[model samples]
Target: MFIVFLKFSENKSLASQFMDGHNQWIKQGFDEEVFLLAGSLQPNLGGSIIAHNTTLVELQNRVNEDPFVKESVVTAEVFEISPKKADARLNFLVGA
Candidate 1:
Protein backbone atom coordinates (compact mmCIF):
# COMPACT_ATOMS: atom_id res chain seq x y z
CA MET A 1 0.00 0.00 0.00
CA PHE A 2 1.00 3.65 -0.28
CA ILE A 3 0.07 7.05 1.01
CA VAL A 4 0.32 9.99 -1.31
CA PHE A 5 0.42 13.48 0.07
CA LEU A 6 -0.20 16.38 -2.24
CA LYS A 7 0.79 19.46 -0.30
CA PHE A 8 0.07 22.93 -1.53
CA SER A 9 3.00 24.72 -3.02
CA GLU A 10 3.90 28.32 -3.85
CA ASN A 11 1.78 27.93 -6.96
CA LYS A 12 -1.23 26.79 -5.02
CA SER A 13 -3.20 29.53 -6.68
CA LEU A 14 -3.07 27.50 -9.86
CA ALA A 15 -5.15 24.78 -8.23
CA SER A 16 -8.48 26.11 -9.39
CA GLN A 17 -7.26 26.30 -12.92
CA PHE A 18 -6.29 22.65 -13.02
CA MET A 19 -8.93 21.24 -10.71
CA ASP A 20 -10.95 19.64 -13.46
CA GLY A 21 -7.99 17.76 -14.80
CA HIS A 22 -6.80 16.84 -11.35
CA ASN A 23 -10.21 15.47 -10.50
CA GLN A 24 -10.19 13.47 -13.67
CA TRP A 25 -6.83 12.02 -12.75
CA ILE A 26 -8.23 10.98 -9.39
CA LYS A 27 -11.23 9.45 -11.03
CA GLN A 28 -8.95 7.46 -13.25
CA GLY A 29 -7.15 6.07 -10.24
CA PHE A 30 -10.36 4.86 -8.70
CA ASP A 31 -11.65 3.54 -11.96
CA GLU A 32 -8.51 1.45 -12.24
CA GLU A 33 -8.83 0.32 -8.64
CA VAL A 34 -5.48 1.77 -7.71
CA PHE A 35 -6.73 4.26 -5.15
CA LEU A 36 -8.56 3.05 -2.09
CA LEU A 37 -9.25 6.51 -0.69
CA ALA A 38 -8.72 10.20 -1.30
CA GLY A 39 -9.57 13.22 0.76
CA SER A 40 -8.58 16.70 1.89
CA LEU A 41 -5.88 17.23 4.45
CA GLN A 42 -6.78 18.84 7.76
CA PRO A 43 -6.99 22.65 7.88
CA ASN A 44 -6.95 22.61 4.09
CA LEU A 45 -3.26 21.95 3.93
CA GLY A 46 -3.67 19.84 0.81
CA GLY A 47 -4.89 16.38 -0.22
CA SER A 48 -3.99 12.76 0.32
CA ILE A 49 -4.62 9.34 -1.23
CA ILE A 50 -4.38 5.80 0.05
CA ALA A 51 -3.51 3.52 -2.80
CA HIS A 52 -2.52 -0.05 -3.54
CA ASN A 53 -2.24 -2.59 -6.37
CA THR A 54 0.73 -0.87 -7.90
CA THR A 55 4.47 -0.61 -7.54
CA LEU A 56 6.18 2.49 -6.17
CA VAL A 57 7.71 3.44 -9.52
CA GLU A 58 4.35 3.12 -11.20
CA LEU A 59 2.70 5.18 -8.51
CA GLN A 60 5.33 7.87 -8.89
CA ASN A 61 4.69 8.02 -12.62
CA ARG A 62 0.97 8.22 -11.97
CA VAL A 63 1.44 11.04 -9.46
CA ASN A 64 3.62 12.92 -11.89
CA GLU A 65 0.73 12.87 -14.31
CA ASP A 66 -1.62 14.64 -11.93
CA PRO A 67 -2.41 18.14 -13.12
CA PHE A 68 -1.69 19.48 -9.65
CA VAL A 69 1.80 18.07 -9.76
CA LYS A 70 2.49 18.78 -13.41
CA GLU A 71 1.40 22.39 -13.06
CA SER A 72 3.16 22.89 -9.74
CA VAL A 73 -0.05 23.49 -7.85
CA VAL A 74 1.17 20.92 -5.35
CA THR A 75 4.14 18.77 -4.46
CA ALA A 76 3.52 15.05 -4.18
CA GLU A 77 5.19 12.69 -1.74
CA VAL A 78 4.48 8.95 -1.96
CA PHE A 79 5.11 6.74 1.04
CA GLU A 80 5.12 2.99 0.68
CA ILE A 81 3.73 0.74 3.40
CA SER A 82 4.24 -2.93 4.05
CA PRO A 83 1.02 -4.09 5.57
CA LYS A 84 1.28 -6.89 8.08
CA LYS A 85 -2.14 -6.73 9.61
CA ALA A 86 -5.49 -5.04 9.23
CA ASP A 87 -8.97 -4.97 10.68
CA ALA A 88 -11.12 -7.79 9.39
CA ARG A 89 -12.92 -5.54 7.00
CA LEU A 90 -9.62 -4.34 5.58
CA ASN A 91 -7.75 -7.62 5.62
CA PHE A 92 -7.19 -7.36 1.90
CA LEU A 93 -4.62 -4.69 2.59
CA VAL A 94 -2.40 -7.13 4.46
CA GLY A 95 -1.21 -8.64 1.22
CA ALA A 96 -0.46 -5.31 -0.35
Candidate 2:
Protein backbone atom coordinates (compact mmCIF):
# COMPACT_ATOMS: atom_id res chain seq x y z
CA MET A 1 0.00 0.00 0.00
CA PHE A 2 1.01 3.63 -0.29
CA ILE A 3 0.11 7.03 1.03
CA VAL A 4 0.33 9.90 -1.42
CA PHE A 5 0.40 13.44 -0.16
CA LEU A 6 -0.27 16.40 -2.42
CA LYS A 7 0.72 19.46 -0.44
CA PHE A 8 -0.07 22.91 -1.69
CA SER A 9 2.75 24.66 -3.47
CA GLU A 10 3.62 28.31 -4.01
CA ASN A 11 1.40 28.14 -7.06
CA LYS A 12 -1.56 27.01 -4.98
CA SER A 13 -3.59 29.86 -6.38
CA LEU A 14 -3.69 27.97 -9.67
CA ALA A 15 -5.53 25.06 -8.09
CA SER A 16 -8.96 26.14 -9.24
CA GLN A 17 -7.77 26.23 -12.81
CA PHE A 18 -6.73 22.58 -12.80
CA MET A 19 -9.19 21.15 -10.31
CA ASP A 20 -11.39 19.62 -12.97
CA GLY A 21 -8.58 17.72 -14.58
CA HIS A 22 -7.22 16.72 -11.19
CA ASN A 23 -10.63 15.39 -10.21
CA GLN A 24 -10.86 13.42 -13.41
CA TRP A 25 -7.44 11.90 -12.73
CA ILE A 26 -8.58 10.91 -9.26
CA LYS A 27 -11.74 9.33 -10.63
CA GLN A 28 -9.66 7.29 -13.04
CA GLY A 29 -7.52 6.03 -10.18
CA PHE A 30 -10.62 4.78 -8.38
CA ASP A 31 -12.07 3.38 -11.57
CA GLU A 32 -8.91 1.34 -11.99
CA GLU A 33 -9.20 0.16 -8.37
CA VAL A 34 -5.80 1.55 -7.42
CA PHE A 35 -6.92 4.26 -5.06
CA LEU A 36 -8.70 3.02 -1.94
CA LEU A 37 -9.31 6.48 -0.53
CA ALA A 38 -8.76 10.17 -1.31
CA GLY A 39 -9.59 13.28 0.64
CA SER A 40 -8.57 16.77 1.67
CA LEU A 41 -5.94 17.53 4.26
CA GLN A 42 -6.91 19.45 7.39
CA PRO A 43 -6.95 23.29 7.27
CA ASN A 44 -6.99 23.02 3.47
CA LEU A 45 -3.43 21.90 3.20
CA GLY A 46 -4.01 20.04 -0.06
CA GLY A 47 -5.04 16.38 -0.55
CA SER A 48 -4.04 12.81 0.04
CA ILE A 49 -4.63 9.37 -1.41
CA ILE A 50 -4.33 5.81 -0.20
CA ALA A 51 -3.40 3.58 -3.07
CA HIS A 52 -2.61 -0.05 -3.73
CA ASN A 53 -2.22 -2.65 -6.49
CA THR A 54 0.71 -0.83 -8.07
CA THR A 55 4.45 -0.49 -7.82
CA LEU A 56 6.12 2.66 -6.52
CA VAL A 57 7.45 3.54 -9.94
CA GLU A 58 4.03 3.16 -11.52
CA LEU A 59 2.45 5.16 -8.75
CA GLN A 60 5.02 7.93 -9.14
CA ASN A 61 4.32 8.09 -12.83
CA ARG A 62 0.61 8.29 -12.13
CA VAL A 63 1.09 11.07 -9.60
CA ASN A 64 3.22 12.99 -12.05
CA GLU A 65 0.30 12.97 -14.43
CA ASP A 66 -2.01 14.72 -11.99
CA PRO A 67 -2.83 18.23 -13.20
CA PHE A 68 -2.10 19.56 -9.75
CA VAL A 69 1.36 18.14 -9.85
CA LYS A 70 2.04 18.86 -13.48
CA GLU A 71 0.93 22.42 -13.12
CA SER A 72 2.78 22.95 -9.80
CA VAL A 73 -0.39 23.50 -7.83
CA VAL A 74 0.84 20.87 -5.41
CA THR A 75 3.92 18.83 -4.66
CA ALA A 76 3.53 15.05 -4.60
CA GLU A 77 5.17 12.69 -2.18
CA VAL A 78 4.52 8.95 -2.07
CA PHE A 79 5.22 6.75 0.92
CA GLU A 80 5.22 2.98 0.75
CA ILE A 81 3.76 0.99 3.63
CA SER A 82 4.35 -2.63 4.60
CA PRO A 83 1.40 -3.53 6.75
CA LYS A 84 2.10 -6.10 9.45
CA LYS A 85 -1.45 -6.27 10.74
CA ALA A 86 -4.84 -4.70 10.22
CA ASP A 87 -8.46 -4.84 11.37
CA ALA A 88 -10.43 -7.69 9.84
CA ARG A 89 -12.09 -5.44 7.33
CA LEU A 90 -8.67 -4.21 6.14
CA ASN A 91 -6.84 -7.53 6.31
CA PHE A 92 -6.23 -7.49 2.58
CA LEU A 93 -3.86 -4.57 2.99
CA VAL A 94 -1.77 -6.51 5.48
CA GLY A 95 -1.37 -9.42 3.13
CA ALA A 96 -0.97 -7.27 0.07
Candidate 3:
Protein backbone atom coordinates (compact mmCIF):
# COMPACT_ATOMS: atom_id res chain seq x y z
CA MET A 1 0.00 0.00 0.00
CA PHE A 2 0.96 3.64 -0.28
CA ILE A 3 0.15 6.87 1.44
CA VAL A 4 0.42 9.81 -0.93
CA PHE A 5 0.49 13.24 0.55
CA LEU A 6 -0.24 16.39 -1.39
CA LYS A 7 0.92 19.62 0.18
CA PHE A 8 -0.55 22.86 -1.03
CA SER A 9 2.08 24.94 -2.73
CA GLU A 10 2.38 28.69 -3.11
CA ASN A 11 0.81 28.27 -6.50
CA LYS A 12 -2.38 26.95 -4.92
CA SER A 13 -4.20 29.86 -6.45
CA LEU A 14 -3.93 28.03 -9.74
CA ALA A 15 -5.80 25.01 -8.34
CA SER A 16 -9.17 26.10 -9.68
CA GLN A 17 -7.71 26.36 -13.13
CA PHE A 18 -6.57 22.74 -13.06
CA MET A 19 -9.20 21.12 -10.85
CA ASP A 20 -11.09 19.51 -13.70
CA GLY A 21 -8.00 17.84 -15.04
CA HIS A 22 -6.96 16.76 -11.56
CA ASN A 23 -10.35 15.23 -10.91
CA GLN A 24 -10.14 13.32 -14.16
CA TRP A 25 -6.79 11.94 -13.13
CA ILE A 26 -8.21 10.82 -9.78
CA LYS A 27 -11.11 9.12 -11.53
CA GLN A 28 -8.66 7.28 -13.70
CA GLY A 29 -6.87 5.94 -10.61
CA PHE A 30 -10.12 4.61 -9.19
CA ASP A 31 -11.23 3.18 -12.49
CA GLU A 32 -7.96 1.31 -12.68
CA GLU A 33 -8.18 0.15 -9.05
CA VAL A 34 -5.00 1.93 -8.11
CA PHE A 35 -6.53 4.07 -5.43
CA LEU A 36 -8.37 2.74 -2.41
CA LEU A 37 -9.28 6.03 -0.75
CA ALA A 38 -8.79 9.77 -1.06
CA GLY A 39 -9.74 12.84 0.89
CA SER A 40 -8.69 16.25 2.22
CA LEU A 41 -6.10 16.90 4.90
CA GLN A 42 -7.11 17.79 8.40
CA PRO A 43 -6.36 21.48 8.01
CA ASN A 44 -7.62 21.61 4.45
CA LEU A 45 -4.08 22.52 3.48
CA GLY A 46 -3.89 19.68 1.03
CA GLY A 47 -5.00 16.08 0.56
CA SER A 48 -3.97 12.45 0.77
CA ILE A 49 -4.61 9.19 -1.04
CA ILE A 50 -4.46 5.59 0.03
CA ALA A 51 -3.44 3.51 -2.94
CA HIS A 52 -2.89 -0.12 -3.70
CA ASN A 53 -2.85 -2.52 -6.65
CA THR A 54 0.14 -0.64 -8.09
CA THR A 55 3.86 -0.52 -7.69
CA LEU A 56 5.76 2.42 -6.26
CA VAL A 57 7.35 3.23 -9.57
CA GLU A 58 4.05 3.08 -11.37
CA LEU A 59 2.42 5.25 -8.76
CA GLN A 60 5.18 7.80 -9.10
CA ASN A 61 4.72 7.82 -12.83
CA ARG A 62 1.00 8.38 -12.41
CA VAL A 63 1.56 11.17 -9.89
CA ASN A 64 3.89 12.87 -12.31
CA GLU A 65 0.96 13.17 -14.66
CA ASP A 66 -1.30 14.88 -12.17
CA PRO A 67 -2.41 18.41 -13.00
CA PHE A 68 -1.40 19.50 -9.50
CA VAL A 69 2.12 18.34 -10.17
CA LYS A 70 2.18 19.77 -13.67
CA GLU A 71 0.99 23.21 -12.56
CA SER A 72 2.90 23.21 -9.25
CA VAL A 73 -0.28 23.61 -7.25
CA VAL A 74 0.98 20.99 -4.81
CA THR A 75 4.07 19.05 -3.92
CA ALA A 76 3.64 15.33 -3.39
CA GLU A 77 5.40 12.78 -1.18
CA VAL A 78 4.72 9.07 -1.19
CA PHE A 79 5.22 6.61 1.63
CA GLU A 80 5.17 2.93 0.86
CA ILE A 81 3.89 0.50 3.47
CA SER A 82 3.64 -3.24 3.79
CA PRO A 83 0.47 -4.25 5.51
CA LYS A 84 1.14 -6.95 8.08
CA LYS A 85 -2.07 -6.90 10.06
CA ALA A 86 -5.57 -5.50 10.15
CA ASP A 87 -8.74 -5.85 12.17
CA ALA A 88 -11.13 -8.57 11.05
CA ARG A 89 -13.35 -6.19 9.18
CA LEU A 90 -10.33 -4.86 7.22
CA ASN A 91 -8.31 -8.07 7.19
CA PHE A 92 -8.31 -8.05 3.45
CA LEU A 93 -5.51 -5.50 3.54
CA VAL A 94 -3.25 -8.23 4.81
CA GLY A 95 -3.64 -10.82 2.13
CA ALA A 96 -4.27 -14.37 3.20
Candidate 4:
Protein backbone atom coordinates (compact mmCIF):
# COMPACT_ATOMS: atom_id res chain seq x y z
CA MET A 1 0.00 0.00 0.00
CA PHE A 2 0.99 3.60 -0.43
CA ILE A 3 0.23 6.71 1.57
CA VAL A 4 0.46 10.12 -0.06
CA PHE A 5 1.04 13.14 2.12
CA LEU A 6 0.27 16.46 0.51
CA LYS A 7 1.52 19.71 1.95
CA PHE A 8 0.04 22.75 0.34
CA SER A 9 2.42 25.44 -0.71
CA GLU A 10 1.90 29.10 -1.48
CA ASN A 11 1.29 28.62 -5.16
CA LYS A 12 -2.45 28.79 -4.69
CA SER A 13 -5.30 28.23 -2.28
CA LEU A 14 -5.80 24.47 -2.01
CA ALA A 15 -9.00 23.75 -0.17
CA SER A 16 -11.72 24.58 -2.65
CA GLN A 17 -9.75 23.43 -5.65
CA PHE A 18 -8.78 20.20 -3.97
CA MET A 19 -12.27 19.41 -2.81
CA ASP A 20 -13.71 19.95 -6.27
CA GLY A 21 -11.16 17.74 -7.94
CA HIS A 22 -11.35 15.13 -5.22
CA ASN A 23 -15.07 14.82 -5.65
CA GLN A 24 -14.53 14.55 -9.37
CA TRP A 25 -12.03 11.77 -8.86
CA ILE A 26 -14.62 9.94 -6.83
CA LYS A 27 -17.22 10.45 -9.51
CA GLN A 28 -14.75 9.29 -12.17
CA GLY A 29 -14.06 5.71 -11.07
CA PHE A 30 -10.88 6.32 -9.19
CA ASP A 31 -13.00 5.66 -6.13
CA GLU A 32 -14.07 2.18 -7.13
CA GLU A 33 -11.80 -0.01 -5.00
CA VAL A 34 -8.33 1.38 -5.25
CA PHE A 35 -7.99 4.63 -3.34
CA LEU A 36 -8.98 2.99 -0.02
CA LEU A 37 -9.25 6.29 1.86
CA ALA A 38 -8.53 10.01 1.36
CA GLY A 39 -8.93 13.26 3.26
CA SER A 40 -7.27 16.44 4.34
CA LEU A 41 -5.61 17.24 7.63
CA GLN A 42 -7.40 19.57 9.99
CA PRO A 43 -6.70 23.34 9.66
CA ASN A 44 -6.29 22.55 5.95
CA LEU A 45 -2.57 22.23 6.41
CA GLY A 46 -2.43 19.44 3.86
CA GLY A 47 -3.92 16.09 2.94
CA SER A 48 -3.23 12.38 3.11
CA ILE A 49 -4.44 9.42 1.15
CA ILE A 50 -4.12 5.66 1.45
CA ALA A 51 -4.10 3.62 -1.71
CA HIS A 52 -3.97 -0.16 -1.85
CA ASN A 53 -1.60 -2.18 -4.00
CA THR A 54 -0.52 0.71 -6.17
CA THR A 55 2.91 1.50 -7.43
CA LEU A 56 4.76 4.72 -6.74
CA VAL A 57 4.68 5.53 -10.43
CA GLU A 58 0.95 5.08 -10.58
CA LEU A 59 0.43 7.18 -7.48
CA GLN A 60 2.62 9.91 -8.90
CA ASN A 61 0.75 9.87 -12.13
CA ARG A 62 -2.56 10.17 -10.31
CA VAL A 63 -1.28 13.06 -8.25
CA ASN A 64 0.07 14.77 -11.32
CA GLU A 65 -3.35 14.63 -12.84
CA ASP A 66 -5.14 15.87 -9.74
CA PRO A 67 -6.48 19.40 -10.07
CA PHE A 68 -4.57 20.57 -7.02
CA VAL A 69 -1.32 19.40 -8.49
CA LYS A 70 -2.17 20.52 -11.96
CA GLU A 71 -3.08 23.93 -10.68
CA SER A 72 -0.04 24.03 -8.46
CA VAL A 73 -2.13 24.32 -5.34
CA VAL A 74 -0.14 21.74 -3.39
CA THR A 75 2.98 19.66 -3.25
CA ALA A 76 3.00 15.98 -2.27
CA GLU A 77 5.14 13.29 -0.74
CA VAL A 78 4.46 9.64 -1.39
CA PHE A 79 5.40 6.94 1.10
CA GLU A 80 5.17 3.19 1.28
CA ILE A 81 2.92 2.19 4.14
CA SER A 82 3.23 -1.04 6.06
CA PRO A 83 0.20 -1.39 8.23
CA LYS A 84 0.80 -4.19 10.73
CA LYS A 85 -2.91 -4.49 11.30
CA ALA A 86 -5.29 -2.20 9.50
CA ASP A 87 -8.18 -1.02 11.59
CA ALA A 88 -11.55 -1.86 10.14
CA ARG A 89 -13.23 0.86 12.19
CA LEU A 90 -11.61 3.44 9.92
CA ASN A 91 -12.64 1.52 6.80
CA PHE A 92 -9.13 1.69 5.40
CA LEU A 93 -9.60 -1.71 3.85
CA VAL A 94 -11.41 -2.05 0.59
CA GLY A 95 -14.97 -3.28 0.75
CA ALA A 96 -14.98 -3.01 4.51
* Best model number under lDDT: 2
Give the Å shift of residue 43 in candidate 1.
0.5
TM-score of 2: 0.99
Candidate 3 lDDT over 52-93, as tens digits, reads: 888899999999899999899999999998888888886767
What would the TM-scores of all predictions be? 0.98, 0.99, 0.94, 0.72
RMSD of each: 0.5, 0.4, 1.3, 3.8
In angstroms, give how far residue 86 of model 2 lies from its true place.
Answer: 0.2
lDDT per residue (tens digit) for residues 1-96 in model 2 = 999999999999999999999999999999999999999999999999999999999999999999999999999999999999899999999968
The candidate maximizing TM-score is 2
lDDT of each residue in 1-96, candidate 4, tens digit only? 778877787965555846787668645525456677778877867777777656678778877777777777778888876666656775454432
lDDT of each: 0.96, 0.98, 0.91, 0.70
> Candidate 4, clashing residue pairs?
none
Q: Answer with 2 or 3, whichever has the higher TM-score.
A: 2
Which residue runs does candidate 4 get wrong by more than 4 Å? 14-18, 26-30, 84-96
Name the better of 2 and 4 by TM-score.
2
Q: Relative to the unseen true structure, what is the Cα RMSD of model 1?
A: 0.5
What is the Å distance of residue 19 in model 2 from its true position? Answer: 0.5
User: What's the candidate order when arranged by decreasing lDDT?
Assistant: 2, 1, 3, 4
Task: Name the Cα RMSD for model 4.
Answer: 3.8
Candidate 1, clashing residue pairs? none
Model 1 whole-model lDDT (C-alpha atoms): 0.96
For model 3 the local lDDT of residue 32 reads 98
